[model samples]
Target: LTTMALVPQVRDAVDLPVVAAGGIADSRQLVAAFALGACGAQVGTCLLVSEECPIHENYKAAVLKAKDSGTVVTGRIGGTPVRILKNPMAKTYIAKEKEGADKLELEEFTLGALRRAVFEGDVKSGSLMAGQVAGMLHEVRPLRAILEELCGGCRGVLERMEKEGF
Candidate 1:
């Protein structure tokens, strides 16, 4: 499941720890995950723009410029949904899908799209994979700074919750 909607149900179904992934970009989301019965959170898109991330600057810029509505889930033509930024390449793919493009056609279009974005800095014609939480990210900070902010925010949130009787 790509959503935390399943976290509570899964946690209640078995005696196992649940790690939530997808759309978890900030400390508030982390707190929400815990409230939803998740013991841990896996962050992905948030790191793509990290200072330590080796992705091309174009990819990072695309992510940084994105808004909450900037991402779209394509790849249904290939039977696997992938969330990516709404760039020229994604728009073309979406248009093709709307016209009932075949799997082979979709594969051909997306082939090397990610590589182009990551290595060649072709944001317009490349696949910039991101999550809905991308808009929550603003800058490319160092890993240490990112971690510290998250932890500090988490603490602040916990303190507020405790004081407010949440």
Candidate 2:
């Protein structure tokens, strides 16, 4: 389900405050979360490309290059899927997992891959963990500018929506 569908249901089901997450990369999404009854939103992929993010340059570049179909999920056989950018290693992992390979073998094959990406800039084999919103990111930006855009852009979107009677 989309965030628009899930956030309201969660808000109504819980007694405590509900914070929305997933695919919340920009002001339009942030505003939608509020409209859906979320007290706040949590964003990650958008920030991963930020200048302040500690991930390796190759990882950030992969995120910046991502398209709508850029990410894939692995670990489905184990009933625990994770989304990461498409690459040789991810493709191989998905193939092995689908073939019902040993879980420990797959785990060993990808172990330290995250460190390889973040520290060694190994985009070809490292795990470039990201979200569906990876497609929305286009550039490397400083944290301040990214935050300002996310917050400041809301006024314009809100104004447009109000004018259109949203």
Candidate 3:
């Protein structure tokens, strides 16, 4: 079955629950996923800044430093455009996007490398997988604050969307 078809299959395969991964951010996205048959959604990029995250300080710092317009999605180097913290490696890859096959040199840059950067403090050669939503965050809030805020937003949305007269 196609990836699209896997959702219902996986959801039905287990009695526990299913959480959708990839690109999910904010309370609205979470709610929408559930509305689409998911029990919960996974959020990786948004968690980069939680006070207890294992990500390196520089990685989180880079994400928090990102601007609303900072991220770029590039597919020129035979890889999908993944949201990431802006850094020298990312910048260079973007600059080479126009070079076509010449840009294939960028393959040397991988998400695993970024993980090294985010998890091992090797900013020079690590890939930092993030989401465009990183722009929405400002500081390293505690885990409780993050959950509370998300829950508050979800509550507000649910309350506002409650049935007309009921």
Best by TM-score: 2
Report the Cα lDDT for residue 17, model 3.
Answer: 77
- Distance (Å) between predicted and true CA of 76, model 1? 2.8
**Pairs with steric clashes in candidate 3:** 113-126, 113-127, 114-126, 114-127
Cα RMSD to native, each candidate? 1.6, 1.4, 4.9
Evaluation by TM-score, superior candidate among 1 and 2 = 2
- Candidate 2 residue lDDT tens string, 1-166: 5788899999888898988988889999888888899998888899999999988888899999999899988887877678899999999999898788897888898999989989999999998889989999999999999899997888999999999998
Once fitted onto the true fold, the runs of candidate 1 whose alpha carbons sit more than 4 angstroms away are none
Q: Which portions of model 3 miss their true places by more than 4 Å?
A: 1-19, 75-77, 102-104, 109-112, 119-126, 151-153, 163-166
Whole-model Cα lDDT of every candidate shown, in order:
0.88, 0.90, 0.70
What is the alpha-carbon lDDT of model 2 when measured against the actual structure? 0.90
Model 3: how far residue 126 lies from native, Å: 4.2
Candidates ranked, most accurate by TM-score first: 2, 1, 3
lDDT by residue (100-128, candidate 3, tens digit) is: 63433566545367668867876655666
